[model samples]
Target: MTEPARDTIHCARFLPHPPAAVWRALTDPELHARWWAAGDVKPLVGHRFTLDMGSFGSQPCEVTAVEDERLLAYRFAERTLDTTLTWRLEPEGTGTRLFLTHSGFDLDSPMGRQAYEGMGRGWPHVLERLDAALGEAA
Candidate 1:
């Protein structure tokens, strides 16, 4: 059996907003629900959340850590497949760099491979949506 996809993937994007703005969107349940899923998602440390994407799939995540306007981490305690999620924001001159990573997937399995590809397509669109919100807010 292949090992799980631990810390093996990296996705990054630059959002045109200050770190504080991006951080709010990341850590606030309401703001996150707006762009992500309009459901229960509290981004506080130790809070558990479920990302229900209708019939697509549902992911259960637990907040792991938070550092002011810098980083947020979640462990995917339950999923259609195994994964850990995290978001890191670093302030640039006039904006923030956002990085999202999902780890611990068994890519050799069909389900795992499917999830891997799906996330690859999904994250960029989500980032684009966040970019628009940031742009309009600025």
Candidate 2:
């Protein structure tokens, strides 16, 4: 029998910037669009927004938690996939270590399985884009 894939995607990187800067990149809409999806992301809880996901259309999201420059969590694709994306930041030697956990994927469904696999491949590239965006902000 074949083993099933894990139902979560996790990524982490040490960015050469302060947590505040990284937090801005994650929250500020313009900077966020330059890195990830285009959305009016803010560091406020209980805010609802939508992201332009290219061909996937607008995906609904809701701010679930915020902790200044340390953490941000949200419900992504709330209308459909209902996944939670959490970003954790920690200070590290004058820079910041960023960690991401995209969980709540239902591996039994085809859409969920596909998204899990696709996002697993795509997040690394997105993080690289984040790096470039932060570089431009410098």
Candidate 3:
């Protein structure tokens, strides 16, 4: 018998900011901390980063991939379930199309279900915060 596979969650946004701008928000610790619940990040690939939002348990994560002005991916560990986050940017008419996929979550398991639901509820607000930050920076 094969092991059951984990369900994945995908969230996407079309931002009114350039891909470079979105890329900065995704990669820079200060820029990310302004929106996402992130802590000190080394700002370099293969480096460790931590995220603590005062409520969610502090997560020890790592930057796994980076492509200038296009993509950023990370592995977030130290949680009830381990996962990988991928951010992709495509240049659109005026700004960029930002896509996020948080894969490796088991929607069937209690913890995974909670994580999936909570992130689905909370990330939109976080994305809004990112928009405001981008506007301010513009």
- Alpha-carbon lDDT, every model: 0.76, 0.94, 0.79
Candidate that beats the other on TM-score, 1 or 3, i.e. the better one: 3
- lDDT by residue for model 3 over 1-138, one digit each (tens)? 964345666767889988888888877778878887767664468888888857667888888887788877888764667888888899998899888888888777898889878887877777789888898878
lDDT of 1 by residue, 14-49 (tens): 877889999878766667766775546555788887
Q: Candidate 2 regions off by >4 Å?
A: 1-5
Residue 39 displacement in candidate 3 (angstroms): 2.1
* Candidate 2 local lDDT, 59-129, one digit each (tens): 99999999999999999998689999999999999899999999999989999999999999999999999
**Which sections of candidate 3 miss by over 4 Å?**
1-6
Taking all chains together, the TM-score of candidate 2 against the true structure is: 0.95
Q: Which stretches of candidate 1 lie over 4 Å from their true place?
A: 1-7, 77-79
Prediction RMSDs, each to the true structure = 3.7, 3.1, 3.6
Instruction: Give the best candidate by TM-score.
Output: 2
Candidate 1, residue 14: how far the Cα is off, in Å: 1.5
Q: What is the lDDT of residue 81 in candidate 3?
A: 71
Ranking of all predicted structures according to TM-score, beginning with the best and ending with the worst: 2, 3, 1
TM-score of each: 0.83, 0.95, 0.86
